[model samples]
Target: MDKRINDLKKMYMDIKIPDNIDSIIDEGVKKGEIKMKNKFKGNLIKGISSIAAVFLIFTVSINASSAFANSISDVPVIGKLVQVLQFTGNKAQGGQVTDGVDIGMISLRKAKNSEEVIIKFNKSQDNIAPCYSISYEKYPYSMIFTVSGVRKFSAEKDFEALKQSNFISDSYNIITLDDSAVRFAINFKKPVKYEVKEYKEPAQIVLSLKECEKGNDKAAYIVRTASYPQGETLGILEERLCGFENIRIVKDDKGTFAVEAGTFESEEKAKERIKEIMNKCGSDIKLYIEKREANQLPKQMQ
Candidate 1:
């Protein structure tokens, strides 16, 4: 009787599902027959006690499983269901809610920074706007880009705007740059005259450096509002220089020669002279514009 008890104990301990399943299936079939025999051979009270323990364990397991399923079903909507299962049992902290249609759960790989977090949401199409937002745990700023709806393919500026083009704006705490103080060197081939005119008032004038030169002494003829093409402008420039009134030749520090004209008293008089010259010079030479004496007058003359 002792030998039989020892054999039954060995059978109970040894009959396990094997790592290699085919072998485990074969062993299970053999063990099932032995277990059946032992059931009959064992004392009635011990057999009943063992059966009761197994039933209790099974009942507890069924109840626990039902409770878990019930908890999952209590989620609010399909979107919430997808969100809950997104990390496959892992919970996402600081996860955002998106606005549009959600297809399913997507696995997010581990990310190092907020930029990576924004990229992850961008990859998922539609509903991305409401679903995701970015935050750095230790940092004060939050960063994110939201899409309003399904994006259609186009070569418009709208698509370009979606890209992380402005890094400063993407970060929460942004320092603004002042571009107002920037200055650059501007060059012009022909002389330009600047005037600040307050309607019907005597205008203040600033002359380009070229207007200060002296050379040819002829009076200039000017025309108002004439458009000059590139090919024809050179001829007009030459005639203006040659025909200018009280033209003078001046020498620069570098010994370059320059042609200057006019110490005319008023802009109207200088323009009248330029117009007379334009009529003499003809239409083949394009006339771009005529500046008032106020603009063309040298600082010494002013």
Candidate 2:
């Protein structure tokens, strides 16, 4: 046995060694690692691209179909995404929709104490005119908002959403008339006054619902600086009117939004306010006086 072991040791020592063996092995290992890293990066990019495509499809589905938007809105986790998606263009509803107009989703934007029901129209087709009318009904108290050139499923996917709102009453519904139109029969819990405004860009209609304020009706004189469309948003107008007293925006029946500064009981006081405003604002500034039917006086800040 000892003689055999000695012979094996002699044979092992007789085998020649390569001087470049370490360098060769290191080069091979480095090549293998780089190949693996490149493979990993390719897979990662493909996966991200696939995910982006799915999300794009999902967003498109939401935009093109109101039923899908309503379905996703009820979801527990992704409910907030509905806020943005509901407003996207639905101009691509191909054949099944009505003849004239393509209606987008109807979303109820609720705030701390107010609610605005928004109805969007696919204004992509310039050939179709988006026209609507507003009327009031009593006894049951319904705000009849009739839109021309629309059908039933046009934008009515979310009437249940309006029903769920604390600000609105039940049985708020949509009625499709024989004349290529749909009427939003919004029933309220109590008598309410609404201000309707038209918007561009996305082309939408907003209904600002205000429950009737009950108290006393008195003559409140208003000094209106400039006349803008009724229901026009006061975006940065207040910033321009800085250093003014009792500044608030009011809408008159003539469908104009005017910057009202200082409430007065008499026309004489309103005239004095107009003088003050002309002095502060440009002398060429257009100013006028109007009387607001008394509800609670608007809260005034300096």
Candidate 3:
């Protein structure tokens, strides 16, 4: 009997366990069994079954020593003995365990002639790559900013304050997604250009928006209605306005393509044409009267 007990101890000692042995044990206890508290100490060969006694002793030992339980919880039939323990439960909860580490509330700071937006986190998240997506829209002329890998974000107070700033003329909307991402739909008084910068230590993302410069020449004037990034939108604009005379698709230094309906000798003539276009295209289309010297006009338009 002594030799048998020694052999059982040695056999279990060589078994290997899993990292999530505690969770597995908790799941088993939730099903029915009472958790063992005291170390096993009983007669080796009492009027009970030897195998049952040895199994109970092993279970009690596992419950008493965390290191021992972790070392042998994955051993073949012994591992499956917990009933609730399975191969995939450990991985299923891994994301939830790590989701707490992420960016938190966002704030906006109004600067003279510009605005600065900052993202804040509980601790340094320098190791995580900040991924973002951007979209621009016409009519009211708005830009959408979507940032991923954020745990939470609140912009109510700062967004309200930004609306009152001289640089921001309209309201903004913020939406938090199910996958820990945030989206911001922002409208400006006029067309603006923006840039993004990042900082470590406390882990912050800074966004700056400034009004885009049109030009300084003033000998002639053009009725410019809309601008789009130099791609599909510009191609569609060109096709839509192909029948109109004096329509020019001009690419700016910032890489945006501006659509000019016509050039006139005076701002009044440009404004008059702008009114006609606005009436035809609907009130949402806002046009800008851009001044240009005779020499600055594109050779084709001149």
Candidate 4:
């Protein structure tokens, strides 16, 4: 075994060694280590930069969402996206989160006689439930309808065209109040007295306006049963009076929906009809003499 080991050692020493092999090997190892370190550092920097860029983009998107919501918040269908992100209040039927208001299309027309202006809300198409809170403010030459729980307005082609109608002395504007309300600014040539009417199945709102009357004379007389909230009461009244002609649902300036049994030119005539109305519709009927302008009489009375 000793002889075999010595022979093996002599053979290994006899093999010729390459010149500068150790230095070459050391240099190659050092180069490989440096290259590996450089590659690792480059990858680490790229990963960090990518993470930073993604974070920045995400932050900017969240911040910009509100501003974008304000601009197109009144556009139907697409507007709900903004409402979902920004609105934290009541939600509509279709998961549309709103401030509890959803306003739809508005329309204005002049009566056939051209003495009264009729403004209608094409509200049925929109998902607005019956009897939402609708109020109005009287300005110098404009009447502003502030409707609550409305998120947007979908303008009908006819209503849109009416914005340019000759009946309107000045232009009307629809402004968004928030995620769930809207204002309809109806501009006219002068101060006017207006009445509101709401219907059920079709889900419509009507604003009838006439120039203010002078003196102590009342414009027209209407027999009212009672004042109720805008929704179910108005609908019930409409159903109850469906069989009668000339009986209509009318709202006063105070946003009260009352049943107007009849309209007459004189108070005496209106009072006389009250008895007949009471006999037909129970004894709860009351008389209302509206001081409306001469031209502002209801279509039937006019």
| Top-scoring candidate (lDDT) | 2
What digit string (tens of lDDT, one per residue) describes model 4 on residues 46-135? 999999998888677646765334324423321111111121121111222324333444554444323323323334344323333333
Tell me model 4's lDDT, rounded to 2 decimals: 0.48
- List the candidate numbers ranked by TM-score, top first: 2, 3, 4, 1
How accurate locally, in lDDT, is each candidate?
0.31, 0.58, 0.52, 0.48
Q: Candidate 2 residues 199-295, lDDT tens each? A: 5455566667776775343667776666554332442454456577655444333434455566688999889877876777667656667665543
Taking the tens digit of each residue's C-alpha lDDT, what string does model 1 give over 1-302?
A: 99999999999999997679998888899999899888777767688889999988867765767533443452232131122212212112222333332212111111112111111122233322223211111010111122222132121222223333221211111111211111111122222221111110111111111122332333332233232222233233444556554332222123222223433445677566556665876655433333332212211110
Which of 1 and 3 is the better model by TM-score? 3
- Global Cα RMSD, each model: 29.0, 16.5, 24.0, 17.7
- In Å, residue 186's CA in model 1 sits off its true spot by 7.2
Clashing pairs in 3: none
lDDT of 3 by residue, 1-302 (tens): 99999999999997888889999988998654432322122343343578888898898988886545644642321211111112231111001112333555455555456766655544324433245555443223345555565565554346666566444554444423235565555555555666655544444455567877742424677777455654556455554555565554554334355666877888888888877766666576556877755323222221
Q: What is the lDDT of residue 149 in candidate 2?
A: 62
Instruction: Work out the TM-score per prediction.
Output: 0.16, 0.36, 0.34, 0.31
Q: What's the residue-level lDDT of 43 in candidate 3?
A: 43
lDDT of 1: 0.31
